[model samples]
Target: MTTLPTTIKRLVNHGPEDYRLETAALPQPGERELLVKIGACGICASDFHCYHGAPMFWGNETFPRYVKTPVVAGHEFYGEVVAAGPGAEEHFGVAPGDRAIAEQIVPCDKCRFCRSGQYWMCEKHDIYGFQAQDADGGMADYMLFKPTSRVHKIPQSLSLEECALIEPFACSVHAVNRASIEFNDVVVLAGAGTLGLGMVQAIRLKTPKKLIVIDTMPHRLALAKQLGADEVLNALDEDVVARVKAMTEGYGCDVYIEATGNPAAVNQGLQMVRKLGRFVEFSVFSRETSVDWSIIGDRKELDIRGAHLGPGCYETVIDLFHRGLMTAEGIVTHKFSLDNWQEAFKTFGTPEAVKVLLVPEAE
Candidate 1:
């Protein structure tokens, strides 16, 4: 085998409006790990947060944050197995030529969180594509995944383009798991973007009584309707909370999913949920924002839940996408290659692009 180059393409943030795609060194795969050649990586909103050095949890200094300058910034990706270190082949069931997707987090199995199966809460946890823990990341040509870190083989029926969405879709699945929505329960999803759309499809599997999607853009709202939303509320024209209450007969929705990452929307979601209802915060807020606590805990006695990265939902999400049960084609209206990554980023700021995918080195 030819020796790989020491450096790879990585996005570095020097300052505001000063992002650089620099050549960083490739990392080695350790025991019980596999080296992967990144096929395609999706540019997440968190990438933008990292670029701006915003107030995201990953950037919060109070916690042992992982986000730093001169770091690669992408987690949503699919790739091919290039090399499997000792024990990895047996552990992951992947060979050199197999197509696979890397799970972003690798928790410490010894932690109480991992012992309880809530590995996402591991104290020594590290986030892929954000910090160079044991891998370079998918923004580059390759990444490394340990056996304990989640990885899934891709289905042949699913196009590589479709596979790129699995990471975010798994996030959707995590939210669904957190909400634990029951059959025929009224669900109000606040946002019609990528994460929002994923919530729509996952909620459908439960056959919700009503699935209301709210967004400022009519185009996105229309797309939500196409994705099986029972009702689409244009926040630009109507009071979202009021409309949601109207749909639920003044009882408000049984569940409210806040996925827009907007602080105001968080409060709106909190206000729109029924008494004893569950509220899932799935959005990555750009900064720390305030909300009404009384409406959240006292009056409603709401079960406010937080859902982050997927711990076990990656394969399930891929299966759903492969089966044509969940599709973002309507939301994935725009596409760009790695060379035009800047254009893709620009498009994400527009209402035109719902789920802008960065097709890096794709055929």
Candidate 2:
């Protein structure tokens, strides 16, 4: 076996706009743990929010504080297995040289949620890149998978770019599954970013009556249409709620999915979704979203669902990608070296960049 490097270049989130790139000691795998050489890691919107000190991640009155100080920042990642600890190869059914990805959440098996099979919402809540010790992220040259990690091997046929995208798309799959979309339901998806575009493709397979995607940017709206959305609405130029209602004969859409991190979209979704509609919210907001409760309880009586991370959907995503049901074509718009993280992070969610990546080394 080749000797591991002595140090690595990593990005650590110190707080809002305080991310510092530093050379850190390399992490070694323990029993049942695996060390991987990161191929690529995508800068997610939540990562950007975390950098800007979002209340949800930094914690506030409503949500408990999450980020432990000075943790490496990144989670949408995949890499090749370089070294495996005792029994890791047998346990994970993977060997050195195989590409693999781990679920974002590293569950505490002792938690009620974990024991009940809902590990995604584990009481411990250790998501990679935020929780310092157990889940250090992949914005570095290498990353380690803990014994408790839920890991899956990637197929060699998939490109390095697509392999890195599986995490976000898996998240997309989970959020779409939460909508309970019906064949005849008119579904409205807000946000044309990474997750939103993926949702467009996934929702198409469900074959909704009509899929209307909303975004403020024209480029993203175009991409959403290209990805299979029946129609695209520019929230910047259109009275989205009014337009969606008019299309549904004043009844509004039957299913509404919110992927835009903006708070205003939350209020708009409540208005555009018909009474008894299913509303699935999948954004990590930078600020608290204030919405009218009566619209949810007294007026509309909607089935509201919140999607967290990708859970029980990685394999389905792999299958989808393998079968060509999904593609990252128009989504991944930018790539930067590990040393150029600042620019890559700044490019995140930009009108021109749907998904920005940090490649450890060029393929």
Candidate 3:
């Protein structure tokens, strides 16, 4: 039997910009539980937002003390199953030495939503890295998967970097499915960042009549083209609504999916999508987004949908990776050792970086 370490290093969030690299006792696995040795953890936009004291995470003056402090900070990660407590194999069918990943949210199986099969919106809403009621997070040398946590086995053929992308790729797949693209529909995807780029590839699999990508970053837009986007538009150089209208002969796109965290992209999608078109919003905004409601109700009659955490989509993403349909090229931009987490955050704040990952053992 492989002996487990007694303690491990982890990045713990104390408050806004108040994170510490500390050593703590390793979490012990219980019945039907799993201990994972983390390989890679991708930094998400919400992680950056939390680092900067966003009201959604840090809470505002009116409602302070939202996030659970001193919690480990990461949700997008993949690791090897180092230890499994009794009944783990019978419950989750996972064994030691297997590569595995769990969804970000851990449902309270007793909640009505969970019992009814809508567990993604469980009432408890305890997401890893943000709350400690369930599992902490994967931002450490090792972490635990709670009994109720949904776990999936990953193929060893995938690189650590590719495995780190499974979470966001699953989100992309959910967003694309939420869009409900038609065979001859013109689809517009806003923001060619990590999630948007992944959506570009996922949308291509639908074989839409046109897959248009919009982004201010030329490099990301170029990558969108390489990912099978039918047309790439530079939002900085042209009037996006006008250009999109011209392409659609003033009909606008049939479907619009917003992946950019910027609030302005929400209005842009409103302007570029046709009346009665479907719009999918997937970003985790740092602030309240105000837009014209009349556009949706009176003018467009749009079918607005919100895509949250990767619910019921992890398997499809893994299958996509297995078939070589999804590639990590141009999406995962940088890797940093856990010691250089500050530098990784700085790089991720810049527009140039697409996806930044932290590897515990990276040199």
Instruction: Quote each prediction's TM-score.
Output: 0.91, 0.97, 0.98
Q: How many collisions per candidate?
A: 1, 0, 0
User: Candidate 3 clash total?
Assistant: 0
Q: Rate residue 175 of model 2 by lDDT.
A: 97
Q: By summed lDDT, which 10 consecutive residues of candidate 3 come out lowest?
A: 58-67
**How should the candidates be ordered by TM-score, best one leading?**
3, 2, 1
- Per-residue lDDT of 169-247 in model 3, one digit per residue for the tens? 9999999999999899999999888888889989999999999999999999999999999899998899999999999
What C-alpha lDDT values do all the predictions have? 0.78, 0.90, 0.91
* Stretches of candidate 3 exceeding 4 Å from the true structure: 61-65
Worst 10 residues of 2 by lDDT: 342-351
List model 2 lDDT by residue over 1-363, tens digit each. 767899999888888889999998888889999999999999998898888878888788777788997788899999989999999999888889899999998888998999999999999888899988878999999999988899999998888768878999999999999998889999999998888988999999999999999999999999989999998999878799999999999999999999998999999999999999999999987877799999999998999999988898999989889999999887888999988887887788666898899998843
Alpha-carbon deviation at 295 in model 3, angstroms: 0.7
RMSD in Å for model 3: 1.2
User: What is the Cα root-mean-square deviation between model 1 and the actual structure?
Assistant: 2.4
Rank by lDDT, descending? 3, 2, 1
